[model samples]
Target: MRLSIRSWVKRVTITGSILAISLVSIGCFYEQAARSRAIKDFPAPGKLVDIGGRQIHLNCQGRGTPLVVLEAGADTSGSALWQPVQEQVARFTRVCSYDRAGIMWSDPAKGQRNSHAIAEDLHKVLRAANEQPPYILAGASMGGPYVMTFTKYYRKEVAGMVLVDASHPDQTARLAQATGEPASNPIPMAFRALAAVAWTGLPRLVLPDAEVPELPSQTAKAITAYQPTSLAAAFAEAAVFEDSLREAGTFRTLGHLPLAVLSRGKPWSAFSEAERAAGGLTREQFNRAEAAWANMQAEEAGWSSNSTHQVLADSSHVMQLERPDAVIAAIRDVVVRATRANATP
Candidate 1:
């Protein structure tokens, strides 16, 4: 039977649609595989806490008063970001760090991605895990705001706070503007999509330098195995909740609480002009100018009303990873203050 021109056109359209769908499906399949590989490569947390319907992966070591809870940044970072400082602090008091919902082994369950929601989830995690209250909350980069918002609403439960390169409202606004979004949108979904693609695909294609900081051998193997679920959840959370925290008034209720701000001091213009010629600021984009702006605003928050601000000049954004001594000192300082406050006449 001979086919009419109209029928041929329909046949071609259907074929194209099928091909497009197949490609997308294949891409997703590869993404899942890569994620599985990444997760299988990393280290597992010390324990798990069930909160808001999800099980959060966490590691806690040492024992002492004034419990310290460390929050990781937005990307795929977990407690691993504190590798530099973890052991050292573990010597002093009980130090706990965990992967947030949709990252690592933390199941993204039962909450929105807003700052307030994330903060509340942390609270629930602490309570469910039986972590004693009057605790000190410390978060770096995106985590800064997470803990700050937590303290804002759960002031009575908190003992103190440590904001390290936390996200500042003004800085977030600038980034949103730079990426062409209304300042109102906190987590820039468009930018996050691009970042997700880069983190997921580029590393495999480019093959990182062997000298690049690598996870420990066993840890690396575990992370690689757990890749699929971890990456998928992380990407999903970044797309939804990261910017969700930026919605106006999400953190309007900050209360007066003891706080410390650790600002990274890597200068943007310090990169050799030659390096600048290569690309964007190398020393510290997120932790330098942008982080400074955010930390400053956080300093203005009621929590920082009588706080100590420390500029970590020798460190990068990952102060915990790069300068554990400084991070430890900062945490210790806060612990001392809290101790003194409790003993006041």
Candidate 2:
């Protein structure tokens, strides 16, 4: 059959769309089955507290005052990210970690996923769980701002804070100006593609988040199992990351509050080889980024007069996991200082 080129192109387009639809259906089925299996295999370790109509996962341990509330960063396995830290901190004082809505076992949340919204949800979960105040908050990455927002709202309740390689509110603008590159995800297109097919469960096979070797064995297992299911939620949070930063930016300062700003010394580790290749980021650009990051961390430390700023010389962004000793020391230091202040009065 001698078909016109226009007709042939039209047919190909229709056929391609049909094939895409079929693939999406198959992917959806695969995704649902995988989700079922995953839920069965890895149930929520903590109890689900009813925060209004929806419930969020909250895990608390130990038995003492000045509770340590840990907030995990963007695209992380929420509470599992703090297992190692929580375990140790729990020995001396009460510590808790929870998944934000739509992350891990928590109920799906609605509205803008900004830091303020996240902090509000955490407050609800804490109240629902009967977890009292006098909290020492430890937030890592985006979690830094989440905890900061919490401190802002519950000022009197907060005892201290620990920012673990925390995100700076102005880093996006500052880094862009510093490096001559727009602030962006390491691989935006790739992430978007994965996010698109995330429901079809293709990324689950392609980007299997197995054991995070840097973390403890048990913690790694929990994160591995929960992570695959939370990819969409993680990316969703990443999408609104700038909003979260801006919301956290409103936090004027911690005053003379006991605070610890733990910055990563090995900033280059944050920009991976793949990231450099994908973004065409050069050594000079990365060096500029590191310089900006160091300066930003110093500024974050200045948020408090009674604050200690330390750069973990051997650590990366996930310094809590890479250098747990340093993270533990920082959190414990804040906790100790906070406790002393409380005792003095």
- Candidate number achieving the greatest TM-score relative to the actual structure: 2
- Count residue pairs with overlapping backbones in model 1: 27
The TM-score values for the models, in the order shown, are 0.73, 0.89
Q: Residue 334, candidate 2: how far off, in angstroms?
A: 0.8
Question: lDDT tens digits, residues 176-238, model 1?
Answer: 444343445434565445446543453333433222153455554444444434454556555
Per-residue accuracy of model 2 over 1-345 as CA lDDT, tens digit each: 457888999999999999999988998898888888877877888899998899899999999989999999887578876777888888888999899888888887777778888888988889889999889999999889888888888899999999998989888999999889876673378767886777887877787555677666766666665665666677777778888888889994888899999998965665579977776678888788889989999999999999999998888788777888888888889989999988885
The 0-to-1 C-alpha lDDT of every candidate, in the order given, reads 0.66, 0.84
Q: How much is the lDDT of residue 277 in candidate 2?
A: 73
